[model samples]
Target: MRNVMILLLGLALCFLAACGANESTQGNNGSGEVEGQDEAEPAQNDLDYPQKPISMIVPFSAGGGTDATARALAAASEPYLGESIGIVNTTGGGGAVGMSEGINSTPDGHTITMVTVELTTLPHLGLAQFTYEDFKPVAQINFDPNVIAVPADSPYETIEDLVKDAKDNPGAIRVSNSGTGSIWHIAAASVEQATGAEFSHVPFEGSAPAITAALGNNVEAVSASPPEILSYVESGDLRPLAVLAEERSDALPDTPTFAELGIDATIVGCPRGIMVPKDTPDEIVEFLEEAFMKGAQEAEFVEYMETNGLGLVVGNAEEFGEVLAESHNFFAELIPQMDLN
Candidate 1:
């Protein structure tokens, strides 16, 4: 009896040790990190979003207008966010690649996309891997109407003169745009449709390069945002033909709208905004919208935009969302009619 009792006690002690070991490792995911949270990542709720420095993805070249606006906004918004906002320039695939990376990121508000009008156009063109349905808009922060221009010393004097040149040349006029399916390209194409211009559509990576091409006389005309080509126009290196908007820009009041020029052209320009991945929690999206909009409205940010001739168009999340959907549907119908598609 004594020997059996002693053996039972030994077994009980071993079982207790096993239980202790299991308890110690209950939440471990191996590598000594807990399953739910780790030392580096403390437990967080929806309200506690952006525990780390946020990354804003600017899907364009660094020195472009988009990049400059993104940097300015980030600097302005950092105070409200209480964390640094880093800008990441992911350029390629006519902006589809960078937007893909932004939309597919960890579905956390930490990674935001500085989405542009391309967000709607790319999916319709079959260039993007994702669709607008994957978007969670923070806000629409900018709206720059398209401006088509030529070198200052070009033979074309007026908007009508440019159209006449196109009609006379029969696709000989090399017109440069930001990309094949870009907003600027659509502007150039719309001009072609309206006036039977038959322009030789040459696409570059971004507006800066497209404008550069026009500056070098590689292309006879270039279509880009007014803010982008403002310096060139002011410097007399380029001359504005027409703006693709209902009204003229404050900066370029002399630049006539397409309607004023008697061209029934499709208005195309980049309206940029902030968006997080679609799966990001609602509270986080709300928080981001409020913070970003407030940042966009900051005096310094507004001054920077106005100084650079960037049109500031701020809207709430819902409004921005409506704009995206409406623009998407418009392009859906419009893309079917275009020859480029």
Candidate 2:
């Protein structure tokens, strides 16, 4: 009986030791740090870039203006990047889904997203959980100017004519855009503030569908990127009313700008840029910037811009980041006034 009791005591001691070890390990894991283990992994940025295929996420759906822009940019950048560049479309929640994916991506520089004016407006509108600070800007591709377009047979010939009708009809004039707080939507808002005109706002899935609605005469007007409406304008299905830039578009040289039309605000084109998670290595970001800056000037790229009716305003990472900051600040102020929540 004495020997059995001693054995039981020994077994109890061993069980206590095992339980203590498990509890200690659970505590360490919950704390997310191992004792004496370094969390910061050293990585050099200037190393040979694109050791593998790069992935670019386009937040908008395929066949839209943003997706087209992504394809052209990917094509232009692949040779310089020294790897196959793959475009992944992850669209939902008015582009917030793909943006969330971008913000949560690994910081190895292998993955990034093409961000548009939505980058500025999403957080301001409370549609996005992450803000511009969550990203590290890589490079800016171009500015996609918003152009006002109407059906070819519409009575309104110019921007002034449209504004006159809007003023008289109040909310009778129907205008279509991709979504609330999108660049096109903001352009319409700017027009309203400038002219004190009112119109019924119609939101669509993306610019293509919005342009299609305008083409089908479901909406009186559409505010979309030049590429979205260019083909129809060329085919005489739509009439170009005005370009939102300070200057006219090269694609439509005869068109007038909003500034020329005496609008107080310049809607100008929203710039599209590339961004990675905020914690990405500086070297990887620099590598991508260098590649895109050079690739942006290629003749094929210029042809792509012309073919798509987009303006290429290529800039390096720092300049792009500055532009992004300015846009973020601008939308942060503008959204509140428009009551875009």
State the lDDT of candidate 2 residue by residue for 1-341, as single tens digits.
Answer: 22112112222122223322433211233243333333222233458666789999998767778888888888877777778789998876667788889999999889989988688788888878888889999877766667888999999999999999999988888999877768788788878877888978897767877888998999999988777777888899999998876667777777787877777653535678799999998888887876766566555665777677775665567766776777777677777887332
Compare the candidates by lDDT and give the number of the best one: 1
Q: What does the lDDT read for residue 281 in candidate 1?
A: 90
What TM-score, over all chains together, does every model reach? Answer: 0.84, 0.81
Judge candidate 1 at residue 187 and give its lDDT: 76
- Candidate 1 wrongly placed segments (more than 4 Å): 1-46
Q: What's the true lDDT of residue 198 in model 2?
A: 90
Evaluated at residue 221, the lDDT of candidate 2 is 96
Candidate 1's TM-score reads 0.84
Over 1-341, each residue of candidate 1 has an lDDT whose tens digit, in order, gives 22112112222122222322342212333353334431221223447667899999988777667887899988877776778899998887677878999988988788998988888888888888787789788887776778889999899888888888879988888888877788888878888888888788898777889999999999999988888989998899999988877678766889998877778877666778899898999988887776776676566676788789887666678767876777787688887788663
Most accurate candidate by TM-score: 1
> With candidate 2 superimposed using the best TM-score fit, by how many Å does residue 66's alpha carbon deviate from the native?
2.2
Q: How many residue pairs clash per model?
A: 0, 1
Total clashing pairs in model 1: 0
